[model samples]
Structure formats: structure tokens, C-alpha cells
Target chain A: MLLVLAVGPSGPSSRSEGVLVRDNNRSHNVRVTDQVQSSKVPVTVLTGFLGSGKTTLLNRILNEEHGMRIAVIENEFGEIGIDDALVIDAQEEIFEMNNGCICCTVRGDLIRILGNLMSRRDRFDRIVIETTGLADPAPVAQTFFVDERVRDELDLDAIVTLVDARHIVWHLDDERPEEVENEAIEQLAFADRIVLNKTDLVSADELEHVVQRIRSINALAEILPATYADVDLVEILDVGAFDLGRVLETDPMFLEDLDHQHDQSVTSVGLEIAGEVDEGRLNRWMSWLLANQGVDIFRMKGILAMEGVSDRVVFQGVHMLLDVETDRPWGAGEERINRLVFIGRNLDREALREQFSSCLVEAV
Target chain B: MSGLHVARIACRAEPLAELGDRIASVAWASDGSALAAGSLSGQVVISDPTDGAVIELAAHELGALTVAWSPDRRLASGGQDGIVRIVDRTGEALAEHKGSGWCESLAWAPGGGGCLGAAVGAQVILWHDGGQLETHDAPSTVASVAWSVDGRRLGAAAYGGILWFERGRAAPVSAFEWKGSLLALSVSPSGKLVAVGTQEGSVRVHRLWTGDDLEMSGYTGRITELAWNSSGDVLSVGDADSVTSWTFRGRGPAGSRPDVLGGHGGRVLSLACAPSGRGAERIITGCADGRLRLYSGTDRSAPLAEIDVGAAVASLAWSPTGDSVAFGDAEGRLWLAEVAP
Candidate 1:
């Protein structure tokens, strides 16, 4: 496997403890691209259910000195509240850093903030992103891969999950646990390291049972027990982990590898394209998708090398709504490609991929 | 139906004289033959429809903000000085009614002889021939007022919501509350539907009798005005970005969203739909970007004709005979353009 090396800033000065495993060494044979130059900037995605100690953990992180210049991106569910007076240097809404980390509001505010962060590359050492309790990680993850500037300037690190151990069993047994579990499990599923916070409140057997549950969902992930999410900073950072690489390595059993499938409630499918598509065809396809598949598909995004266009066209749809915009051109020596990832339940992946591929402009 | 015939009328944009710096409000008569243009200088210009010749009438003190004409062709003009002046065809002030607050919106009852309604502060006042002004307390600051066809009820759209009142009732006949502040309201010709445009970019349509509401959402900006066609089947709503039309199909359920009619550039301040039997009656819209557009509800892909008015248009009205259209702008200039079917 050829590893594409990304040329940019030099790697961080600190040494990484983990051994770099070659692509062929893994059973999945995933091509691990060394294209991104790591700055050792740990972008910790603090995620949990609503009112699940995410902000509390954030407040603690801000108070303690970890030596690294941490830029926190706080994504509040409603209107943002005033932060404490101690963090006076923080930007009210979205701010960047001179050390390499960038912070911003969540969801819609992500794109603009990331775009701004990429413009000033030398500013941040690491980024810590916090998401609203209800946000799906797919869109945020896709952002790092979809934009060339983002992929070059920043490297996606570990996803840290904060679990309420006291309410875990009860939360899992509720009628709509699928709602809470979907976000929780997805965050955990993609995490390189899991911090089962608030463990002091749960019984010893219950804590062990929860750990087993987490392992059942993701066997590859390292589970770390913590009373208040207080773990050594070195464990969370410099993990040298990439889930996308793991996903590609799984090959034949890509989606079927996990023992627990995405909640019988929600599922996702990746649609690949071999050729450029017409603008009109895309519009018709989107209208048809909105009319027929809108109710079923909660989120959908497509990055296509559109016909007659030099730059890739990125389309994002929330429920029945769709917005399309042009992104940066394909990088030097990079292939002009078309790839769409759809996350929803009961979706006919084969049929959708076929329909999406048929929309491609036919060669004369 | 017959290949969608679209006709264009061209008018040379000429700056109006005598409208110097004191201009206020402008409107057109029902027949579209003449215009009732008022100014802050207490001057009114009654211009000919075919050629821009004026019949100037010096009517009041202080600037006029709104103008309306009764079905019988009596011109009613309201000013910021809290005075309502009723003028005849020759531009002579016939009746003058004095009020306490600024009179912003003026409308005549459809079939009633000479009855008129004006929104002054938080009260909606109905003025009759005997010089009596019937005042009704509005839920909030009254923004605009419109009278139903029968003249039996007057609908007032306030900063809060909708207030419907009958002639003799001390209390409101009925009221409807919406999520955002109300900007304008329009009642259907048959008195069946009342449409209210809100600042939150939504148009809420309520059946006059049942109090049922159907909301149509699409605009990301504020809705400025609303108008109903003569037949009352179609409705045209004006928002900050565009003007949309909706077909009220006999009112079924609550909270129904209507089909959107999209295409317009600036804030659409006013809209007027032609009466029935005019052969695909078009919707005329006045925009803040100073463009008067005519749109065919059948094919909303493009505008039939766009007239550059050179200033933000404040109001638009269609002729009773459907042969012409009248438009007013922020500069107190009124234009009457001949329409060919």
C-alpha cells in the first residue's frame, strides 16, 4: 500500500509513544495515509446526553493548566451563556489560537470557524471541540475529510466520551434509549479512548457490566475508568488513531464488523461515484430524495467532482432541506473524485448508490 | 391557458415635479384613470392615468402617510398629523375627521357607501358619513387596518396579532395570536379568509368564520404585506425577499402549509392581485429595491414585466376594470400604467 505523505508544517516536537503500525500489518489492510502532518494537537470531542457533565468537564479543563495552548470550541444547544470571568481572553463566540487549537460554536457555525482557522495555520497547538448533546458526529467528521484545507492544516485526533455511570443502566432501559444511545454509542464507537466518568456513583458490578457493554460496542477502543474524567493528559492525546483508516481496512466486512449494529433505529450507508454528475441531474435527484427519502434519512452529505467544475461541490441536507456550495479545488496530485455518505435507517444502500451513480453525466 | 400570453408596458422613468422634499403618500383611484398622490407639504397630485399630468390639491398640514379610495370613487387620505381627509373626484376635501394618534393605514369598506377604517396608535377607528369615529381598542400597537367586503366587520393587524371587530360590538368579535409581530393584513373579497403577514417571515391564513389557521413558511425574512384576489381563491403574500402566492382550497385542517411561489430580489413591500375573469389575473408586487413586478401565478418561473420605479414602492392596487395598475412609492409619487389583456 502506498502511503500518501501530506507536506505542510513539521510534526510536533514531543515524541509519540505508540508504535506506527504499517497498513499491511492490520488484518483490514486499510491504507493509512501519512498525508496529514501531526502537530500533536489533541482535538477532544466532549460528548454525552443533555445535562451529562460535558460543560462541567469543559469548565474543569479550562481551570487546570495542561501546558498545551488549548483552544476550546463550545457548542451550546440554545443561546450561549456567559463564561466565568477567569477565561477573559476567550472569544465570546468563535475564536482561534496562535498555538494550533481553534474553538467555535457548534453545527452551522462550524464551517465558517474552520474556514477561518485554516487561514491562520500557525496559531493553534491543539483543538478541543465540544458538541451539542444531540449532534451526530458524522457531519463534523466528514468536514475534516471533505475540505482539503482542513485536512492539510489539522489532524483529527481522539473522540472523548463522558458517560453518566449512575444513569447508564436506567438510560439504556428507557423506551427511547435509542435516541440517547445512538449519540452515546456513535461517540464511543469512534473513540480511540473512552473515559467512563462518574463511576463512583455506580456499584462495582454495574461498573464492570457497563465496561463490558462498552467493549461489546467497540472491541478495538481502550476503556479508561475515571471517577470524574480525571485522567493523565498523555493517555488522551498522541493516541495516533484514525477511525477512517480503520473503516477502510475492514474492507469486506466494513460495516458488519461491530457486534452491535447502529441502533436498529438508525443506519448509515456510503455512496461512491465513478464519474462527474450534472447540476440539473443533482437537483432532480435531491428533489426526489426530499420527496421520497426525506422522512427516513435524517442527514445526508455529498462531495462531488461535478461536471465542468474545477472545485468539488459539497451538498448537505438536513431532513428534507438541502444546501449546496463549492469547496476548495482538488489538491496538487490529488484525484478528482465523487463520494457521498448517507446516514439514515432502513436505507436501501445498493438502490441509492445505483440511483446516485445513474445521475452521472454520460460520456459522449 | 392559451400558451400564457405575457404583455409588457413600458413607461419612461421621469422624476415627479412639485414633490420636492415634502412628499408623503400616494395612491390611485379604483378606475385607474387618476392618482391620489399626497405629500408632507400638504399637497396632493391627482394625475391622469394615460399621460402624467397632475391635478394638485393642497389638502392638510403635516405629511400624509396613507391613502385609500372608496368603491364609489371618494378619495380618503390620512396624515401623520392625526387628520383623515375625504376628497371628491375633483381633488376637493369633502369631509375631515380629527384623531389623537398618527393614522398610518386607511381602507374603505368594500360595499358600504362611504365608511372608512384607519389604524391610529393602538385603536382602530371606523369613520362614517355623520362625522362619528367608532374607536376599538386593539390588542397591541395597530400597524395596519382593512375592512371586510360587507362593511359589517373591520380587521386590524397589530404589533401583537389579529383583531376582528363588528360594527356594534364593544369587544373584538374574534382575535388570533401568531408567533411574531404582525405587519399587514388583507381580507378576502368574499369575507371568507383573512391573511396576516408577520415580521417572522410567515403568513398565517385564518378562515374568517371558523378561526382556523393555515401557516405558510419559506421566507427567511419579514413578511411586509398580503393581498387576496377578487375571487378570494388565490392569495399573494409579500415578504422581505420575495412575493409568494397561495391557493386557499376551502380550508380543511389547522396549521396547513401552502405551496410556495418564489422569485423576487428585494423586500416585497406591497402586493395586489387582479380581479377574476381578467384572463389569468396577474399579481403585481412593489419591492423596496424600487421594482414593480407582474407575476403569473400559473408559471412562477419568471416575472411577466418589471417596471423600474426608481424608489422604494410603498403600495400597489389594481383597477376595478382590470385594464390598468396603480403603484405608489416612498417619494410620494403615484404611477398609473395601462394594462393590455
Candidate 2:
């Protein structure tokens, strides 16, 4: 099978030895394109700056009759008991704790709490982790991938970041403090869905300016303008944001190899090819790319046109955790083009595009 | 011959809540006199089997993950409150150390070492005499902790692998990179090897001398419990509906296969191997279908006795003497079974 994926977690040095394998005896080839690892429950991470309406969003998710059982894990700075009356009436299992931060320091607590929940699996169907506005989303997301127990039973669905429309620009432009870690940039950089929360709090012009600023920082994320964090539950739940299927569905120019546009250190590279790839040669090239540049390539995803497969290959990675699976077959009259996208720091676009282009099968 | 009895403890079951009495862990005192059960609501119930004398102490506000009796017969436990407390005969706290995260597992060093090891979050705290606690960082969240039978090293199982800490050292002397969360740990009687059960349904054996690893897989569910026979010649592990034992003889568990002990229809929640101190090689398994069965090594297909309590069995432990077994259930009930030959 031809693999199309990005090595994520860190910039281009770490290797993802992780595998998502399903070996069953099936004769008919009816396949689902999403390949979101159906057996495990999905966890959506809600992160934003302080006062970004994360709690308001959580309260809404708690009160709504979404027909899904959600366990809310909240890490806060002080002892704000999450509106006990409201929580009790909603009949949600709310676990709140005061920790250093959800980023790296208090991930252990999150894992422990998650482990406890996994044991009593009959109670809840999904999980929503609300990070401290000051917390980083990387470590929190990494926990779901690194914990062997959690990875087996849970999937990292998406990081839904709610940005305060009125006051996010100051955070965007202000020099990052060395101690607190410029969480603002990461909140934007790592988000799968950026909710311009409280859009009414800002004027139309101001909203446009903030949106533009966010776009410059993260060119790929889908930005949704929302009032009071009110977005359809369908948009966020089970988006498989970590899987890259939605991005591929929406962006046809997924392989354009656009110029880098984010942090001075962070960049993006996209490539598209029309020829079929030899699976063996493609694997060798990918192994080399991930070995030499895995840590730098934070997120890589691609749909491949391969020599001996009617199905579109879906491949994704986060640092050293790579996943590849056969998606829905090429539709009737659809073009068999290969597309690849990589988001990371200090990407060598020219060299990578050239290296990937070499994997195409040579004409007879 | 054996007889079993259930304590008529009035724990009002309110669906998932058990009147603050859902038993999380249970253990018999090292001296084999009293059995202690820790509950999610932070209550510790110690009962004397000789008579029906029982003492219940509200030790923690939330829940306790583990309870253990030191070689000196003092009961110590760790709880969801992140507090480790040592209690005396009068149910008074002798000492308490507050860690940051949930205090999940506790193990006492064997060979009368008088050292207690605990895994609280990502750090393993070792408590020696005089209320001194030594903290060592774990690679990830520690699921279980065990001490070598000789008390030379302590092992903490987490996501990346098993970390081995030398006695009295702050750093892990070595690590076994198994790439999963290790849910259960068992050290052989000779301290020559350790067996760990992973959430990915594999039991891995690590030789203490060479760091060589052996993996035994093909289980239907995650391996939740592991126990070794007295001589440590065989290791027993549990899955969804079966208990399997693998030989640890010549080259460890490399070429060794497992003998299956069929179980109830649902998941096997807990497993206990009778202490070989009394010439018994029997394994007890509690299943999600509320069935508890004891299987002798000789008779693999038939269980010695099957009991039904109508609640999922949460945890089980064999008395050090191998004469009795104590088990706790999801609804906070405790049962004691005494066997005689």
C-alpha cells in the first residue's frame, strides 16, 4: 500500500513508529473513507485564551440534548467548582481540578482521570477536555497519542480553539513572555477549528482584521465566526480533525506547495502529482523523509494515486505517530491525482517536493 | 473442602454510587489475620475473619486506589485524593504525605525490607522509616508499581515502558520500552524476572539480569491482572473470559505457551493466585457477569466452586497463607472464602 502521511508532534527529526492496523478476513471491499478508528471513543479538546468563552461553550454542550454522553474534564487555575447546581441538573459527569497547567505539568492528572473513566466505560460515550486559557494544547493532545491505554480506547478528535474576537489581536502581536510560553500562537497554530467567539463583541471591521491576523498565523484551519460559542455540535463532534480527511475533502488545491506564512520558524509545504506512485519506492522515500525530517514536519497528510489500488490511500501523522489506511475507492469519472500537505517549522519545500516527485513511477 | 461467606454490609446501591462504598482495592494483612477493603468513597473496612469484628474508617474524602499492610502489620493506603496515609491498629493516621495527583498504586518491598513504594501520577514516591519520602520521576503516568522479591529494585509501569529504580536511588537504573500502558505487574518469587500486563492485551516478561523481553499475546481483551506461582515457575494472566498461565522455566517465557482456564461470558475483572506458601496452586477469577470461580492448576477445565453475587467483581486477593481469599464487587460488597484440605 502506498502511504501518504505527515510526521507530527515535533519538527523534522522524530520518527513515528506507531501503527493503526486492522487485519480481518473480509472478502467484499466496502470501505469507509474517514477511517477514524471506529472502535475507540473520540476526545475533542477545547482551548483558547482566558475569557474566550470556553466555559460558556462547555455549559452549552452540557445542557443541550445532543443525545451523546460527554464527560467534561476541566483544568482551572482556582477553585471554581463549575456551577454545581447547573452541572448537577444537567446530569453530566464533570471532573474539575486545579493544576499547574494542562500543557505538560498536569498532563499526568488528565491521563489518570481518563484512565479511571476508561475502566467504567459504560458511563460515557465521548470526552471533552477544556484546557486552562493559559494552557498549551500540544501536550494535552500528545497524551492521547502517547498513553498506550488511552490510544487503544480513545481517539484525539480535534482541537477546537475559541478566540475572543474583541481582544485577540493584542495577544497576537504582543511579544511572547518567556516564562508563560506564548500560548496565543500555539492556540492558533494547533487548532483544527478556530471559533471567532463573541463575534458580536467586536465590530465587523474589527472581526475582519482579527480573522485576517489569524489566517496569517494558521493558513489551514477552518475559521468559524460564532456568537457566544454557538456552533452546531455536528461541526465539532467526530470531525476527525487529527485524521486530515475533512481538510482533504474541502481543499482541492491541497498539493499547491504554498509559500510559508506563519511564525518565522513555522512554515507549510504542499505538493501535487498526476502520475501513479510505486508503493515500494514511495515507502522508501517516506521512511527517509520521516527519519531525517520527522520532528520538523509536525502534521503531514496526503491522498495517493498508486499503481495497484482502486481505493484512495489516507495517511496522516503527528510527530512519530503515523497512520495509513485505504479510504473510499476512486469515484467514477474522478481524477486520480495525488495530493500532500505538510505543516511544520523550517520546511525545505524545494527539496521535499523534488524528493516526493521522484517516487512517481517512470513511464515505459 | 472450603466454605465462603459474604458480609451483610448495608451499602445502598444507587446505580453507580454505592452509598460511598464502591470497593476499589482489597488486600489481606501480611500477617494473614485481617482483610482490608478500600472504597472509592475513601472508606477502609478491616474485618477479622476469626469473629465478625469489623472497623470502618473514613480515611479519605474521595476514593482509595490501593491498600497494603507493611511487614509490621500496619495498614497503609493511597487514594484519589493524592494522599498516602499510614494507619495504626486504632485506625489513627501515623503519617500522611500529600502528592499532587491521584495516588494510584502502592507496594511494599519484600524480604522484610520495610520500604513502601507508591506511584502517584508521573512520580514514584518511596517511603522509608521515620516518615521520609523519596520521589523519583516516572517516564509517564505510572499504572502499577512492584518491588523485586529481594527488595533490590522497584519497577513502575507506565505508557512508554517499565522503569526500574535501584533501592534508595532517585533515578531509574534501567527501563524496558514496551510502548503501552502497563496495567498490572508481578515479580517472580526469586526476583529474577517480572511480568507485566498491558492494556493492549499482552503479558510481557522482563528478565532482571539481561533486560531480555518476552511477549505473550493473543488474548481477547486487555490483560488486567498478573500473578506468579509460589516458586515463580509459572505466570498467570487474565483477559476478557479466560485466565492463562505461561511457564517461566528454562529460557523464561520465550518459547513457552499458555494453558487456558476458561472463564465467565464477560470480562474477567480480577485474578488472584493462591500463595504457594501452603502447597496450593489455584487461581481465582472474578468476571463482569458477577461470577467468581477458582481453578486448580491440575484441573484446567473445571472450577473448584462457582459463586454468584449479582454484581461485577472489582478486585480480589489471596491471603498470604493461601487458606482464604477475599474479593470486592462493584456494589461495595466483600466476600471471604476459606478453604481446607
Candidate 3:
């Protein structure tokens, strides 16, 4: 069964007009705009836990006659090296990603490899990186933002993570090291789109439970159910999931029934508070919070009503870096409710809530 | 005085098969018969300047960070993919070494020692054309690696200090401790002084015997270049702007003010000291803004000649006789200049 769920582009206008390689010129045409996006290529990252149907989705995307030439970067664990044998042949191009973890030791390697690929823009239209199983997607996603050359030559589209419906609980329940939490949970927490694959393997009741569990962990990203990784091409391509303007897309009532209780330390913290938060205090609080405990907190997004400000302040963060921006302004007589959601490991909910509440301005 | 003088040379350009792939590093054969260039695109090529024939090979599919030529003319390259390859001039893979991370640096023992050393991940492996000869581990990723002229000792520089490994020893012979990240290393021809450029814009000269090390400051950014003049009494360094040479005569560069040489609009990207053990020592520097300058004298204060290769210089190398020099730029072009006495 191929279940296709439609997830709309979060913020189309926010997508930087990726400095497009015009044609067969093969020469870099520089544009004057945001220094990062002027001459960059679009890169999509697909990640998930082992047996999560990522390869299946990749194969499907490659096989489709979408008219777009895509380059696939496959990363397999070095010692085992099973990906080479499971290699899929497609009409498009495929290459190996850097060897070590993209975040730490092999960062330089990724810069070189990506810079090299950008130099040869005639071959591939877009780039998709399929990370190794049991890999954290944050580092892969961060590569574009961290490296000046990569950022200047690559636009990050989104991080799409596939979930194994039948064994989602089992993988998430696996114990993790102290500094490093469960990779399975991190995959889900970091995704812009969560594909609940292998749904047929579970009963209807089990599928419902899995969806609920996933929502409890990450209610911001769109959740789609699928079988054998079958999904529509439009749902995956050109989606501006990383746009900061529309990042805080949670519905006001989505967490109404969210009485989350489990044996795990990892979960989402959602808050809807009234009154405006002082802009200065909010910045200080966020800067301090992220600086101190950013590693423990995986992902966070919020829409805040700042004191004396007509526009809503949108904030999103991954690890230590936070992206803050002003989004659409408030309408006439609209209820200015602030909403925030944090997905992390072993979070002190009360401590965070109290600190957040301190930033609020009192109502007359 | 500007402490800078401008001159030009009759330099010739010989490009590779492809352009725009920035040359990452360059090296010359021990006998000056061949020149090997590694690019940011992972393509490595060995060229003959005499006849203009080029042998191109995909030495690394990603890119290579460093490359060197042994005494026997075999080229050893360390790449971004963490693979260290030793290949002949004809593109034959003589030997290959794999580390857990990117192979960031490579060096060959001077003289006929035939020792090749590479830094990959947190370990440094000293090998030849055959197999692993010796291995040493560091507390952090090694930024640079070098060997004594006689190939009797190996020095791997990392964050805390520079670890010295003796031949056939499983443990380090000694360590020159510094509290910063060492980005470049240059062991003098006499193997008496081990100079290091650090993450901070400074240079450190560590005397092997006395354990007395000196730190020279005043550069603006991280030091990317280090070299020793012919007599080993003068050490020249570049940290993006001006090139400086310190007097290493008596107490060995300790508490000595250095003589700053030349400056460029861009940072000094790479440095190559004269490789010929028998000639008058000179210093060559390549800058980020596409300028290459050569300086003469024990303090390297006299400017000899320079050329604007029209691209950011990525790497440079000197021939054995100090009569010729080869350099590669970020625009993927290689050039050779003849320095007439």
C-alpha cells in the first residue's frame, strides 16, 4: 500500500531564490543578495533509523520521470559497507558522501566534496544526501549553514525522515549514551516531514498509537503514512521546510488532547501563553538558554507576541544556533496568543516554563 | 621603510586538464624532474615542465589537502576523504593508507631517507612506498606532520603540543607543549629546530635538545606558513599579511624580535622554503589575493621578485636547485618561474 500524505510548503516566500546555474555556461554567475544564497545549489537531506524505508523512498524518487536531474549522496557505515551491495541504479547520478561523521571530524571533507560538486553543476539539477542508518540528521543539515563555501553554493531544502511504523517504539525505546541520546528519536525530532512507512506491518489500532506517539514527540512537522516508502513527488521536492518565517506552524488546539505520559525522558513541551514577552528579555533568555543547554535540546520553534511590537517574532533553533525573524503582522482585534514547542531529552519542563513566563508582560 | 619591495618574474602558466578546480596543494619531485599538484576537486596530476606532458589521475574523488614527493620521485598525497595514497609518476598506486578521518597533512623525510609521514584523524602514520613503518597517536586531530632531515624522527603537531616520534618507537620520544592549536609545522634542514604555526596568529620555535621554546606574536590571524632559511639561523613565517623572519642564531629564536618582510592584499596562503640542501636558502610565499613573492637573505628582508598568477595562490613548491619554483592557484592553474641569480 502506498499512502501519500500532502504536506504543503511551509514558507514559499522565505525560500531564497537559490542562485541558479543558468545554463550550459559552466561559469559561476555571482548575484548581489543574501551573501549565502547568491550562487548556491539546492540540497535535500533524507534521514531515518535503520529499516525505515529511506532507501525505498530514494529509489522511488530517482525512478520517477520528474524531469529534474538529481544527484544522490549515499553514506554507509565504513566497517560493514553493506550499502555498496544494496546500491540502486538510476538514470540520474549517485556518489558517496564524506566518510566520517559530517559534523565532527569529516567536516572539512564535506566542504571539499560539496565545493567540488557545485563546480560541476552541468550534471545534476539538485543534490539529495541519504545519511547512514543510525545517523543524526542535525549535523548533515548544519553543514550548509556552517560552511561559508557550502552555504554560498548550496540551499538547504529540508530534512525528510522516514519512520518504521512496525518498530518505531522498539527503536525509540533503545537506551542511549549520556551525551548522545537515541538516534531514532533524533531523526524524528529533527525532520521537517515524517513519513510513517511500513504501516501495513501494524494493525489499525497500532498504527493509530504510533501516529499519536510521533505527534507527542514532534507536532510541528507534517506526518504522512505510507507503505513501502511510496509517496508523491510533489510532497518531497522544492518544499521549503527550513524557512524560519513559517516554522512556528503549530495549531492553537493541536495540543488540547496531549496528556503525554511515557517511561521515556524524551518528549515535546508545548506552551500557549497570553500577553507579550519583552523583546530584550526574550533575546537574553533564549541566548542564554541555547548557549547553556542547546545540546540537550534538539529542536525548538515558537511564535511570540513581543511587548510593543506589532509583528510576531518567529524563532527556531538547532543545537547552539538560533534563527530569529519577524513574520507577518497581527490583524485587527486578533487574539495575540504566543505558542512554543520544544522537543528534547530530559528537559526540566517547570524550569523552562518558569523562565519563559518571566519574559511575559503583564496585562492591564 | 615599507619593509616591502615589488618585483616581477618571467613566469609561465601551464594549466591542468580542467580549470576552476582550485589547486589545494603542490609538490615537486626530489630531483626536480616532476611536479605533482592536487586540486580541491580531488584530481592529482604529475607534470613534466621540460616537455609539458601531464599525467592526470583521480587521486581522491573528494579532494586532497596535502601532497609531497619522496626522494625516489614517488608522490604521496593526503586527501579530504582520509585516504593517503603513494603513487608513481605514471599514476600507479604504489601504496595506500586509510585512516578513520580525513588525511589533512603529509610530509616526507628529507635527504634519501625515503620516509613518508601523514596525519589522518588523531593518529600519524610514518610509512614508505611499502607498508606502515611506525604509528603515533595524538590527543587531538593532527594539523601538520614532518620528519627530521635524516628521517630519524617524526613530529606531529596538534592542539596541546607537537609530539615527536623516533624511528621504530611505539611511544613518542618527546613533546613540545603549547596551549594552542598548531596549524603548520616546519622542521629545519639540520633537524635542530621544530617550528610551528598556531591557530592564533603566532609562531613557536622549539629547540629539540634544550626543551626551550619561543613564541613570536604580532601577526593578525592564524599562521598558515612557516619556513627555515638555508643556515637554519633564520625562520620566516606568514600570517595572512606580512611575512616575518626571526633570528634563530644564539638562544634559538627565544625572546627575539622578528624582521617583517612583505605584505599582500590577501593573506599568505602557502609557504615553501628552498628544498635544495646545497644552495643559498630563499623563502617563497603565495597570497590569497593571487600574488606570489620571493624574498632573499638570512632574515628574508630583501624582496627578490613576485608575480600575480591571477588567482588566489593555494600552494607553492621550490625545486631542488633553488633555481626554479612551481605554484598552483585556486583557479586550478600551475605556474613555474625561473629565478636567475
Q: Which has the greatest lDDT?
A: 2
**CAPRI accuracy category, model 1:** incorrect
Q: Write down the worst ten-residue block by lDDT for model 1 chain A.
A: A96-105
TM-score of 3: 0.72
Top TM-score prediction, candidate number: 3
Question: What DockQ do you compute for every candidate structure?
Answer: 0.01, 0.13, 0.05
Docking class of 3: incorrect
**Higher-DockQ candidate of 1 and 2:** 2
Q: In candidate 1 chain B, what residue range of length 10 has the lowest lDDT sum?
A: B1-10
What lDDT tens digits, residue by residue, belong to model 1 across residues A55-86? 66776676566554556665443212133211
User: How many steric overlaps does candidate 3 have?
Assistant: 4
Which ten contiguous residues of candidate 3 chain A have the minimum total lDDT? A88-97
TM-score of chain B of 3: 0.90
What's the lDDT of the predicted structure labeled candidate 1? 0.59
Compared with the true structure, what per-residue lDDT tens digits does model 3 show for residues B70-188?
87888888875678888887879888877766687888877776778889877899885447566677777787898876777788987778888876888898888765567788888
What lDDT score is found at residue A261 in candidate 2?
49
